[model samples]
Target: MKNVLILGASGSIATLVTRNLIEDSRVRLTLLVRNPDHLADDIRYDSRVTIVVADVVKDTAHLTAAMQGQDLVYANLYGANLKQQAQAVVSAMTTAKVTRIIWISANGIYNEIPGRYGQWNAQMLGSTLTAYAAGAKIIENSRLQYTLVRPAWFSDKDLVSYELTQKGQPFKGTEVSRQSVASYLSALILDPSQAINQSIGISEPHTDGSKPSFY
Candidate 1:
């Protein structure tokens, strides 16, 4: 069985990933959230799930302890202090001797997005993207084997179909379903070799436009 640690477990994407993984008998989960009370009873009570209530950014010691014996760490985290949080996770993982990680970042980080949607996204999320870019850099430079996922703007759609763009390629599309992102992350967790040590951009094929289709 694979022992997986999910940081920021209460977030929307992480919750979906958790649900998908728990259905598989081959995986064991450690859910690290800021508030255990926020989790659904089904997840809280699952036999294969272990809940750890602590902030990954401020609880380095606790995070390190939780990383012990885990095969992989998946972080679904973001915010102003994202770089610091990434640093904390890296330190803890190093201490725990865990070698693999899958981290979520946004599509605009590299300024490699094209067209009107890219211009708008950059103008709107410039500051946040700066921090995300820095955080991605931190993870990329770390000794751990890491896959940094840069996903397009999130959609509420349930579709799992998506496409990937390698590091140097322009990020395509204005939006991708949250479910698609979750599914991709879960697949990576199950088989980390597919995109090891790479920063990938994910989006739905031919959905490229000036803005998210839902808008």
Candidate 2:
């Protein structure tokens, strides 16, 4: 069985992925959360799920302990201190020799889409992109086998399925469901043979029916 560790497992997108993993019998999940009581009843009841409560920013020792013995570490941390979170995870993973990581980053970290939408994304998320850039560098420099997924604007709507654009390519479309991104992250954790050691952008297809819409 594959043991997976998820940081910021209490967040919306992380919670969705946590539920998906719970239903999968082949994987054992350990969640790093700030408060175990904050988790839903159903999740707290699952025997396969292990919850480790610690403030990641303040306690690197606890974070390191929770990461040990896991096959893959899935991260969904955001905000200004996101870079620090990434760095901490890298340190812990390296200490444990866990080696594989699936990180959730934003779309504009590689610069915007290069047009009108690009300008809008830059104007709206410029400061946020700065944090992602730092986090991205951490992943790139680490020895871990990493797959960084950059999702377009996140939506809570139903999952419509999506596509991927590898490093150096930008995904088209405005937004994607959080469920969609979570689903893809679950897939990456389950199947490490695809998109390992790379950065990819994921989004829904366009209405124009163009060829290869995402990348």
Candidate 3:
């Protein structure tokens, strides 16, 4: 069985990933959320899930303890202090001797996105992108085997079709569904060889225009 620990388990994308993994009897999940009460009843009561209530930015001791024996760590987290939180997670993972991690970052972090859409995205989300960049750097420098996913502007679409661009390439397209992001991450957890030690940019194929379709 693969023991997985999901940080920020209550977030939208993480919730979707949780739903996808819960049905598999071979996967064991430990959900770390700031507020356990916010989790859906089905998730909170799932026999395969262990809910840990604590802040990822603080509560280092509890977080490290929860990381013990985990085969994989998926961090779907964001905030102004995202870099600090990522550092904490890395430290905890090191203490627990867990080496695999999948971290969610935003597109445009490298400022390699081309065209007017890229400009608009940078203008609107420059600060948050900067934080994400720093967070990604911390993970890259760590000893862990990490996959940093930089996803395009999110859509509420139900489809999972998407494309990938490697780091340093111009981020393709403007939008990808949240479900697609979750699905890709889930697949990586099941098979880590596809993109180990790489940063990938995810977007829906041919969705590129002047801006995201959802805008």
Local distance difference test scores for all models: 0.92, 0.82, 0.92
Candidate 2 residue lDDT tens string, 1-215: 99999888888888888898898889999988888887888888788889899877788999999988899998888778877888888998888888899988888788846566667676778789889888988898888899998888777677657888887775576677788988888888899777888998887766112222232
lDDT of 2 at 130: 87
lDDT for each residue of candidate 3 in 1-215, tens digit (9 for 90 to 100): 99999999998899999999999888999999998988888999988899998898779999999999999999999898988999999999999999999999999888878999889999889789899989999999999999999999999998999999999788999999999999999999888777889999999999887789867
Model 3 segments beyond 4 Å from truth?
none
Among residues 3 or more apart in sequence or in different chains, the pairs in candidate 1 whose N, CA or C atoms overlap within 3 Å are: none
lDDT tens string, model 1, 70-91? 9999998889889999999999
Candidate with more favorable, higher lDDT: 2 or 3: 3
C-alpha lDDT of residue 86 in model 3: 90
Please tell me which model should have the higher TM-score, number 2 or number 3.
3
Model 3 local distance difference test score: 0.92
| Ten contiguous residues with the weakest lDDT in model 3 | 206-215
Error of 2 at 215 (Å): 23
